[model samples]
Target: MKLPKALAFDVFGTVVDWRTGIAEQAAAFLARYMPGTDPGAFADDWRNLYQPAMEECRSGRRPFRLLDALHLETLVQLLERRGIGTAAIGEGELLDLAYAWRRLRPWPDVPPGLAQLRKLFPVVTLSNANIALMIAMNRFNGLEWDAILGAEVSRSYKPTPQAYLASAAALCLDPQDLCLVACHHSDLAAARACGLQTAYVDRPMEYGGARAPDGSYEQAWEWRAGDLLELVRVFTSH
Candidate 1:
């Protein structure tokens, strides 16, 4: 099948190594602020809260909140749970730590693949990350993006049709004209349900290879590749 006119990517695990990036930042911050915390496990714990936090809004338990605000709230709760009181960690320190999400390192293939992919299609993000967070990460990591369109734009998180549909609307394209490139099956499945094309990028090490992907790739998808470079090749070759 021919590719779509625009590509919207899932930024977290698809484009960047969040685990290592968060662990590194947490290590640097906690070493000076709160000693004896395992940085890697700490990173995992923080990420572990991502879905449920978003679910609060998704389930309509709370109004739409930016990922940045969720991150801050989660961090404060985590610190207190670890017995690191607010007095021990000031507001400035908490804010700095929460902003670590903006400093993630890209997967090795990301920059080159995105640079090449941009030549063929209008490439933008469809992440749950807020607009400011996305912009900061792109500038910090030197990613090539035509626009940032995602949860913040729609005020709706992924798997919700609004997030995907809103992204297409932002670019003034039909949902069918846009492809959602992601490492998570649930993400692509949701996009497919909304009539958008799906491209799966295999990131076996997204969770440090500790867990397998949700299922086999037996279902039909527009494209699947081992990495972004491979996805770029698939697009260019067809």
Candidate 2:
């Protein structure tokens, strides 16, 4: 495979353990706000709303909103379904809960692996996360990124051609010159369709093992690896 000019990453499940991070933060919030709630289940429930919320914007049913906004909206909905009214929680508290996304813990391989990858090519985020949230995660995780470009810059969500094309454009490279690294095959398929190279990185525990790992693809990709470190090895080997 030809070397890519830049490596665009899908941040959430690919780089960080969002489920664990959200559950950890939710535990404290739930203890005080809604005692006896199962934080892990709560985290899963909140995450289950992710795609449908983005689909609203993706389908043009609503104007594009930041992931932060969508997260807050979903959190409110989740809480309401539990019989907790918005009036029961202060806006400050709600915003703090939403900010949990910004403080996610990186997968064990991510920080060092990304540092190694950056030496070879410009490594930037191609995530649905907004710039501000990405900034916070970068700081929180000590991640080194060449740039942060994705849905916010593209004004569209992943699986949409615009998100992939716009992210490549942000780096002043042809879509084929950027390799999208993601755990989700659907995201990689979308990038491939947009003329970008694709790398499938296995993240078996992304959903905390609730779902089966999707290592299979309809067709071979430019690369595949078990983790970011393995991806670095693949690049160097090529």
Model 1 — which ten-residue stretch has the worst lDDT? Answer: 210-219
In model 1, what lDDT does residue 175 have? 95
lDDT of each: 0.89, 0.91
Query: What lDDT would candidate 1 get against the real structure?
Result: 0.89
Q: What is the lDDT of residue 129 in candidate 2?
A: 98
Clashes of each: 0, 0
For residue 205, model 2's alpha carbon misses the true position, in angstroms, by: 0.9
Residue-level lDDT of model 1, residues 35-76, one tens digit each, is 888888898888888888999999999999999999998888
